[model samples]
Target: MSAPRVFVVENTLAKMAREPGGRNAEAAVKAAELRIDGVKDVSLASLIEKAEQLGVLAAEARASGESEAFGPVYDLSNAIYGVAGAFGLKGLAEAAFSLCDLTDHFRSGEEANWPAIDVHVDGIRLLATLGEKATAAGADSVLDGLRKVRARVMPAN
Candidate 1:
């Protein structure tokens, strides 16, 4: 039999990140969807699936008090930010990237540099909740802190 066909998700997040703000939210979303759809012809589907496995690894490291072993976890988060940024979702992207950096920093033998994981989790949850509220309010589209974030990431936009 021939090799099975695979899919790869496009990196729309990176594209969106470069756009920033209301100017490109819709385009970012649409591009993201298209990127997701592209996974049918490559290995991106497998790559996404691996995220679950990585989560398990991260949990194990955390449980074992081997926080320094979280480098891989940070890499994964950074990858997500790259896509988010491409899609003009700078707020979400930055948050994710920052979390990765913080995690890695603490994991790398840096004393007094540990981040508050709980706070990051709460912030992410709040952003999601706010996005839902905005959608409910019939807002055109909602990306929390994107307006401010975009200004920083894509100043020209």
Candidate 2:
């Protein structure tokens, strides 16, 4: 029996970084951050669209009082969280995460806390309206309110 020979390939990205004259890793990272920051406005557009869509869905769920109606809210909040976090919208990202946590509590328990969902929807909208300045005074207040709202229903853990 003959053993098959194994070939190892160096990662292209690693090789490029290690090669002489290659761009400085730190400089490349800073350059990428600048590029990402340029799209901050575009991220707000996305946040608006996502927030609008989530608002409608949450409103419907509140009206019907059906647990299943909020099913997609959790999934959509994940997308919201991703986009908000990627753009460094700290307040918005925190709000999205709180929504996700509240949604989990809503889904697990027998009765749904529709009002809490509404609170989160409103919070998200407020954060989005505050725009790219994640640390704005309004954003901080909204985030603080959301934390309290989510804390009400979330089981201590």
The C-alpha RMSD in Å for every predicted model, in order, reads: 14.7, 4.2
lDDT of 2 by residue, 1-157 (tens): 6898889887999776677885777998999999988987887798888988899888877787767776789888888999988977888888898888877777775588777888889889878776675567878888788788777777578
lDDT of 2: 0.82
> What TM-score does each of the candidates earn?
0.43, 0.78
lDDT of each: 0.51, 0.82
Superpose all Cα atoms of candidate 1 onto the true structure and report the RMSD in Å to 1 decimal. 14.7
Kindly give the stretch of ten consecutive residues in candidate 2 with the minimal lDDT sum.
126-135
- Give per-residue lDDT, candidate 2, residue 85: 86
Prediction 2 TM-score vs. true: 0.78
The count of residue-pair clashes in candidate 1 stands at 22
lDDT of 1 by residue, 110-144 (tens): 53222344334334334323332323223222234
